[model samples]
Target: MSDASGERQSPAPFLRLVRGNPTPEEAAALVAVLTARARAVQAARDAEAAAPAPRSAWRAPSHPAGGHPPRGAGAWRRSFHPG
Candidate 1:
């Protein structure tokens, strides 16, 4: 897991395999896969942030006053402001 910067990070198994004495090729492959996955995930997150958010069906309707209505009042309007 990298921070904001795009720096290389060591995988969990890399350290374990080092202590357990893994083969050189296996270690290299593990590192490659982990780094690729990290980059892919970061790219996906960046794309999502850049993309416009989809409209939500569950989103509250905009009020004429240009702000959200008081919470929990949508179902209680009739009782409080009887017609």
Candidate 2:
């Protein structure tokens, strides 16, 4: 049937088949099962979105050249220069 704008639109084939075929009890059961499954999926997505993000373990390294040379600096310099 045509909608407000007068453009004709037909019901989907799967919807027409479902509407025409199922008994009342079967239709109710199907609706209940699908509704429960949709609620479960939405709840799982909400829980995941609310969860906190994990933090990284690494920290920023301290600078070593500001008059506080790093450990083993003397050994490293002597090894490199061989003087």
Candidate 3:
């Protein structure tokens, strides 16, 4: 039980099952099952921080080669071909 930097601590599994001393109704049923497993891990971290937040359907055109279309060599000619 020496904790304040005195070392020798390790006992927590509910203090090693109350090292043969539990009576108060088995320590109030192990503190109501460790407080319902700490309220189910804080309600799963508040439903993962209220979820929803993931969107990106490709988008990055504000000029820099906007709607592309213009590169040398008759840009794939077609204005009445058949020569």
Tell me the tens digit of each residue's lDDT in model 3 across 4-77: 88989767675346367888898889889989999999999999999876544444454543345555678656
Instruction: Please write out the lDDT profile of model 2 over residues 1-83, one tens digit for every residue.
Output: 88999999987643233346788798788778878999999999999999987654443245433334335758768555654
Q: Model 1 residue 35 lDDT?
A: 91
Candidate numbers sorted by lDDT from highest down: 1, 3, 2
TM-score of each: 0.44, 0.48, 0.30
Across residues 1-83, which tens digit of lDDT does each residue of candidate 1 receive? 76569777766653355266778898889889989999999999999999998877556465333334445557468545545
Instruction: Determine which window of 10 residues in candidate 2 has minimal summed lDDT.
Output: 58-67
TM-score of candidate 3 relative to the true fold: 0.30
lDDT, residue 46, candidate 2: 98
TM-score of 1: 0.44
Q: Which candidate model has the greater TM-score, 2 or 3?
A: 2
How much lDDT does each candidate structure score?
0.71, 0.69, 0.71
Q: Which ten contiguous residues of candidate 3 have the minimum total lDDT?
A: 57-66
- Model 2 has an lDDT value of 0.69
- Name model 3 segments beyond 4 Å from true: 1-18, 40-42, 57-83
- Candidate 1's C-alpha runs over 4 A off are 1-19, 56-83
- The positional error of residue 78 in candidate 2, measured at the CA in angstroms, is 16
